[model samples]
Target: MKRVLVADDASFMRQMIRDIIEPEGYEVVGEASDGVEVVEKFQELNPDVVMMDIVMPKRSGIDAVKSIVEKFPGSKVVMCSALGQEALVMEAIQAGAKDFIVKPFKPDSVVSTLGKVLEKDD
Candidate 1:
C-alpha cells in the first residue's frame, strides 16, 4: 500500500481526507496540523505522497512544498486549496507540488487525482 501524509490545520479536514483515502488502500501514515508539522512529519515518515493544505500557521503549504522538494527530490506533494486560491495553487506547482485539489473535495476526484499523481512515478 502507498503511504500518505495529510497536512491541514483543521482536524476535521484531516479526518475527512483520511476517511476518503484509507478505504481505497492508501495507508495514511501521518497527519499534520500545520506547515511546520508537515515538514517535520515528512522528514520522519517519508511518505509516498503528501496532501498539503495551502494555508496554515508557522509555514504555508507552498513553503512546505519547497522544503520537502529540496530535501526529497522525489517527493510527491498535492496542494489542497480553497476556491479563489488560484495564484497560490500555481505557486505551489512551481514549488514542486505534483498536483492539486480544491476544497469541498469530491471523493472520486480526490481518489482519482491521487491515483494519477502516484501513477506518474511509475
Candidate 2:
C-alpha cells in the first residue's frame, strides 16, 4: 500500500479524497491545508504520493512543488486543480509533478491517474 499526503485548503476536498483513496488501499498518511502545511507535512510524513491542490494560500502549489521537488527529488506529486487552470497545471508538471487531477473529481479518474503516476515513479 502506498502512503499519500493529501494537500488541499478545503476540508471537504481533503475528506472526499480520503474517502475515495483509502478504500482502494492507499493510506493517507497526512492531510494539510495551504501550501506551507503541505511542505511541512511532506517533510514529516514522507509519503510516496502527494495529492496537491494548485491554488492555495501561503505559497501556492507551483511554489511549493518547486521547493518540495528540489528537496525530495524522488517524490511523486500529482496536482489537483479546478477546471481551466491549464497554465498552472502545466507549470506544476514542469515543477516535477507526476500528473494532475481536476476538480469535481470522479472516482475512476482519481484511481486511474494515481495508478499511472505511481507506476511511472516505480
Candidate 3:
C-alpha cells in the first residue's frame, strides 16, 4: 500500500482527505497542520506521497516543497489549493509538486490524482 502524509491547517480537511484515501488502499502515515511540521513529518515518515496545503502557517507550502525536493529529489508532493489560487498552484508546481487538487475536493479526482502521481517513476 502507498503511504501518504497529509498536511492541512484545517482539521476537517485533513479528516476529509483521510476518509477519501484510506478506502482506496492508501495508508495515511502522518498528518501535519503547518508548513514546518509538514517538512519535519515528511523527513521523519518518508511517506510515498505528501498532500500539502499551499497556504500553511510557519512557512508556505511552496517553500516547504522546495525544501523537501532539495533534500530529497524524488519526493512526491501533491499540492492542495483553493479556487482562484491558480498562480500559487503554478508556483507550487514549479517548486516541484507533482500535481495539485483544488479545495472542496471531488473524491474521484483526489483518488485519481494520487494514483497517477504514485504511478510515475521517481
By TM-score, who's the top model here?
3
Query: Per-residue lDDT tens digits of candidate 3, residues 9-43?
Result: 99999999999999999999999999999999998
**38-121, model 2: which lDDT tens digit per residue?**
999999989999999998999899998998999999789999999999999999999988899999999999999998888883
* C-alpha lDDT of all candidate models, in order: 0.96, 0.93, 0.97
- What clash pairs does model 2 have? none
Q: Candidates ranked by lDDT, best first?
A: 3, 1, 2
Residue-level lDDT of model 1, residues 1-122, one tens digit each, is 99999999999999999999999999999999999999999999999999999999999999999999999998999999999999999999999999999999999999999999999953
State residue 30's C-alpha deviation in candidate 2, in Å: 0.4
Candidate 1 residue pairs in clash (backbone atoms < 3 Å): none
**How many pairs of residues collide in each model?**
0, 0, 0
User: Where does the lowest 10-residue lDDT sum fall in candidate 1?
Assistant: 113-122
Residue pairs that clash (backbone atoms under 3 angstroms), model 3:
none
TM-score of each: 0.98, 0.97, 0.99
Candidate 3 lDDT score relative to the true structure: 0.97
Q: Candidate 3: lDDT of 74?
A: 90
Candidate 2 to truth, TM: 0.97
